[model samples]
Target: MKKGIVQVLCGEGRGKSACALGLAVKAAGSNKNIVVIQFLKGKNEETEIGRRLEPEIKVFSFEKSERPYCELSDEEKQEEAVNMRNGVNFAKKVLSTRDCDVLILDEILGLLDYGIIEPSDIQKLMEARDEDVDIIMTGIVFPEELNGCVDKISRIDTVDIKGV
Candidate 1:
């Protein structure tokens, strides 16, 4: 099996998640198994790509509350933290098992930024990932610690088109 490298996608652009989803579709088209773990997003099957790609692609979300992290009460924050921790554990298990060819950690950077998960947690996930499983992470800012570890880092910037 060919070795798969880690890829990070981040920036102020609007299509980070969309790009990840597109890749999931492409991978599915090639019969590659995919697992997407979304952070900070509530469960909504109607808008979920994983739901549409069921049986081929699996998605798990760590969102326990619909409220924004910044606006959450201390108690709610604590609860969300637990859910995020569980999500991290699940991700570690998936990576270790190597059950899928592709793994997408959607909005994981936001989790780090919001203190939902620690930077060390991400490091652990990267270290535990199987050699054959490609990993994709999408968020607004790339973690500095992962700069040297990831194989490719793509930053998307929005272009203002006043009139099109």
Candidate 2:
């Protein structure tokens, strides 16, 4: 059987994006095409990590601003939401092409929390996914109904962060 999509919803501590990046690196080592779209976090080290790969993984970020040091204003929040929606749409287009072997949708849960991407839209995308591509989606507060369709579901619990 073909390896299936891996949905990792890590709400707690660390290693969410790290895990995804690790998978991407492994896939790239085997010469698989990889695409990563980070909804919340972007342009950090992980984004850079993919760049050094021989084939150079394609990395896209819909987040326009650097990580906020303080709480965001309503306008900034709206802007971020717009970026997230664009990211989702871009992912949809990429998926529609069905070209790559692995596609990563990072921090999509946060987008949903901020009321950016809707679960229903994601449901539609999953319904339409190409069986050949392996997908990894990281998010929080997973919708109650995504029970059977997802091949793997992992919920990372919260852990306290130290000395931020």
Candidate 3:
């Protein structure tokens, strides 16, 4: 059996999500099973890439509303916390199933940013994943605790473009 390694794409660039999506497409094209769990995106606001890969790729979201975290009220934040917890549980289930060849945790670092989930929680998930399931995490800030846990880490720096 082949072993699947963990890959992290993090930093302040615009292509983090795009990179993950591209990987998903490529994996699907190769007949590999892929699952994507988005931590901060809402159902209505999910990117078209997810929609386009439907059936071939499974996409799940934890967001309860379209409002950004900065704009959410205390009550909304509380509700979001529940949703985030659910997302964590869902991820655990998926990882344990070993049904997917690739598992993409999209913007999962945002949960750490909001203090909704701890680094230890992520560490536990990483430890529990199937040996053959490739885990890809994309976020702006990578947790220091996960420094040596992943096999590959790619930092994306934004390059300013004058005009499109």
Candidate 4:
């Protein structure tokens, strides 16, 4: 049997989520089911397009505030912690259930940055996935702790900004 592929798109640049979404689209093109769970960053221009993907690509977010998590007050951050955990649990569910062939945990590595979850949690989730599925995670930070667990890591480094 083919083994599952665990990939991470991480760095201090833009387009990590965009690359994950591209992977989802490629999988869906092959009639594969996809589930995307977003964290930290709240909404963007692409959210509506993702929603339109529908049953083929189910997108979910557990963030309560409309604003990005980074912009929220401490009080709001405390409140959002629960929701983010729920998102993590749901990711585990998706893996255990084999609900989708492609699982995109957008900005999930940021969970580690905020002390929301541990590397062991991610290790466990990776272990629980079906051998045939593919998992893709994106974040601004590359998780050194997961270097051994992840099959591949692509660094997105920004060279320059288009505008000042």
Overall lDDT per candidate, in order of appearance: 0.84, 0.73, 0.85, 0.88
lDDT tens per residue, model 1, 1-164: 79998999999998988899899889999999999888766655523646777888898887667665567788988888788788889999998988789999988899888887778888899999888789999999987887876899999999889864
TM-score of each: 0.91, 0.84, 0.91, 0.93
Candidate 2: stretches off by over 4 Å: 1-3, 42-46, 68-70, 158-164
Error of 4 at 98 (Å): 0.8
Ranking by TM-score: 4, 3, 1, 2
Candidate 4 regions exceeding 4 Å error are 161-164
Tens digit of lDDT per residue, candidate 2, span 79-131? 77787788888888888887578888877777767667677877876766788
- For candidate 1, what is the lDDT? 0.84
What lDDT score is found at residue 107 in candidate 4?
Answer: 89
Write the number of the candidate with greater lDDT, choosing between 1 and 4. 4
Q: Which stretches of candidate 3 lie over 4 Å from their true place?
A: 47-49, 161-164
Error of 3 at 164 (Å): 8.0
At residue 91, give the lDDT of candidate 2. Answer: 85
Worst 10 residues of 3 by lDDT: 40-49
**lDDT of candidate 4?**
0.88
| Winner by TM-score | 4
Query: Residue 37, candidate 2: how far off, in angstroms?
Result: 0.5
